[model samples]
Each structure stands twice: as structure tokens, then as C-alpha cells.
Target: MDIIDENFSQDFHCLVYDNAPTHLKRTPTAPSAKKMTKNTPPVGKNWLVEVNMYDENGKQIYNSDGSYKKQHVQMSSSGFTEDGTPQSFYFEPGHEREGVFKGMAIILEERGFKGCVGRNGRLAECGDFSQGCVTAGQPDCCCRRMLYNEPDFVNVWPRLEEVANARGFAVLFLPKFHCELNFIEQCWGYAKRVYRTFPLTKKEDEMEKNIITALDSVPLETMRRCDVLDSRFRSL
Candidate 1:
């Protein structure tokens, strides 16, 4: 009846990476959409979910020379694969990430909690208003379903605690602003580097497939390179 009863230490449960779109070609010089609507990301249903993404205006994807989009993506989250598995989490993003973030109240109704949030909590890759933001301007998308859109963790974190309480979990949030410590950051970097190795068409679908293939090319190698586990990198 435990989500993850692993001991807390340098390594707790499996590393859960945040999710984000890689190398999205957004630009300012490109002809702008009069009013581009935000694509609604799906809502997750799993007990735990980590996301990496931002609501960058699709039109703002170019620079003067078009070399790079100046947007400062945190580059600290993972994305989904073809089969829907996250870079980690050993579960599907739809069921786990959006589901938990929005369904925490429902989940907690079944489980009981045990620890202060943001302290002694389970492992999770945290995202901010970066890619997961759902402002009043956006429509009803499950990814941003933070239960009431309270606009602050204080207003929303308690519901998560309730879910943990229901499930007898101790929500141990990573340290404030401690993305580097989470192994998932390494995974995002891994996926990006792997995707770049290919022709890597800038289109989302093609590039995402390239990434997933790269991820599948060598699971053990990727895991080692990302340091998902404690082991030396094996040579091919």
C-alpha cells in the first residue's frame, strides 16, 4: 500500500523527471498569429507526475538571425515517448502526471498522508509557470488542472497533502529550487542530445520520435549516461 517506501537519502525512489518540449522552433520574426490559442496538454491521473514545459507564444520562436529562440527554457524536465511512458516514472504520463496533479483530492480520499509537504516528501520533478502554466487566458486543459487554479502552492498544496494522507504517503518535496539534484534533469539533457544526433527535423512529431528512438537505442547506456542508477557507463 505504499507509493514508494524507499528510504530517503542521496537516492530515494526512482528518479522522476519533469516534462518539456525540446528545441521547439518558436520565433519573433516569423509572421505572427493574430491570436494563437494554447494547445491544451492532457491531464494526468497517476499518483505522481512531473512536467517540463512552458506556454511560450508559438509566434515568438525566432531571433534576428533565427539561430536560437531567446526564450529561457529551464531545460529541466522530461517528455513522453511513443508508447506514452515517461523518460522515467515507469508509468504513463496521462495516467500519472496530470492525473495526480489534478486528482490529488480524489486520490487522497482513498489514501492517508504522513509528513509535511516540501519536506520529507517523496521524489518528484517540480515545474512552475514555465511550460505548465494555465492562465485565465487559456482554455480548460488537464495539464494545468491544479484544482481551482489558486495561483499559489499554499492554496493548492494542501489538497496534495490530503491525497498523500489518504494513501499514507509522506510528500517529500525536493529542496526549494533544487532541479539539478533531480536525476530527471539529466534525462532531459540526454533526450535532447540524442535527438540532435539525428537529422532531427524541427517538427515536433519527427523530433519526438527521434528522441524516443535514441532513448530506446540503448536503455542501459542512456540510464548510465543520465546517471539514472549508480554504475559505470558501459562501452558499446
Candidate 2:
């Protein structure tokens, strides 16, 4: 937008391609850890178990002199807290039940975000998310799937479009799940491969040097090649 405003008179278009969670301004609130009770069996999914070794006398084992000896026993799915509630419970009704998506939607609506075009190609206006939406598959319920499909023009996108429009430019979004057409993905993969080639080291300074070296090693020709390849694929 800035470059076009400064150098060109004709309107320009900004095309954005995104798929990963990194692009979302705010992520969905994570579920509270499942607590384990005496009667409740161990959990299995998404839980880690940590055990501390103690001597026969029931006291925590210590190192030879003063340091405490600590070792990771194994990863377990056992319930963490006694109750289902979070250990440090900050009960945010919206975030707890519906997740951060509702909170994000509320914030956006408050800031004049009217919501985005849905898969049906209609503007899905913001609703009262303080009370969570109904689950999908029910009669007209705004379930998790629907919420995900809702248009999001709150953060980076709205700002980008606003700036571009003010400078006589149009902002376009690439089709969803079309990463193969994005040349940047190939460049990122190439960069990661280069980064992996660096010699493994423990020193922080050495690691930083290796990272910089790997990034700087990607030639401009390689970037051009990636873009050309992407164009060819798109044409095909």
C-alpha cells in the first residue's frame, strides 16, 4: 500500500494467502486440564505425567550434597487436578464454554466489525456470543464448525484492506487450502531445509550464528525460481 501510494497512480491489489493458526489474531481458548480423582481412572490424550522420586522414608531424594535430584519418570494421561476444574481457575464463561472465538467475535463487533461472508456467500452478522452459540447439526445451531467458517476481518485483514482502499488499491484473499499455489511456502520449506543443515551446537551464540547463516544462504535466484515454479503450476 505504501509503495503504491508513493510511486504509482493506478490502483493496486494486495493478495494474501494464509492457512495456519499463526495468521489468527487470537487463538481459541484451550480446554482446562482434566483432573484425576481417587476413583477416576487415568487420562490418556493430551496429558503428561511427571513423577518425583522419593526415598523409602517418604522424603524427596536429594543429591550427594545439596542439589535435589529430579528425573522425568514417564508421560502419563492421569488426571491432573482432583476435580475437573482448572488448578488456577479463572472462570471466563464465554472462553470456558464457547472458547476464545466468541470473545474474539465480541471484541471485533464492539470495534465495528460486522462479521464476514460465510461459505454460503452471505454476510453473517455478529450475534450475542456472551451466551455460546448452539452446536452444529441441530436445527440452525451455530456450532463450532459454523463459528470457524464465519468471516474474520477484525485484525490484520481489515487494516490491510482499509489502507489499500484509501490508496486506491484492492485487497484479495487467496482461496482456502491452496498453499501449493503460494510460492512463499516453497521458500519457507527451502529455508527450513537449509536451517536443518547447520551443525548442531549447545552454545546460544553459535545457534544464532547458524540460523543467520542458513537464512542468508538462500540465493535470490532460488526465490525467483520458486515464484516461477508456482506460476507454472497455477497456469497448468
- Error at 221, model 2, angstroms: 2.1
How many times do residue backbones clash in model 2?
1
> Candidate 2's residue-wise lDDT over 1-236, tens digit each?
56656777464455454644443322122221222111112232222234456789979887789766666322211112323422221213553332112222232233243442234332232253224444323322332223343333112244345555576665444457888778788777887898898777899999888778877877899988987887777667
Backbone clash numbers for all candidates listed: 36, 1
lDDT of 1 at 118: 31
Write down the lDDT that model 1 would get.
0.37
RMSD (CA, Å), each prediction: 21.0, 17.6
Q: Give the TM-score of candidate 1.
A: 0.28
Cα deviation in Å at residue 142, candidate 1?
41
Give candidate 1's root-mean-square deviation (CA, Å): 21.0
TM-scores of the models, in the order given: 0.28, 0.37
Worst 10 residues of 1 by lDDT: 31-40
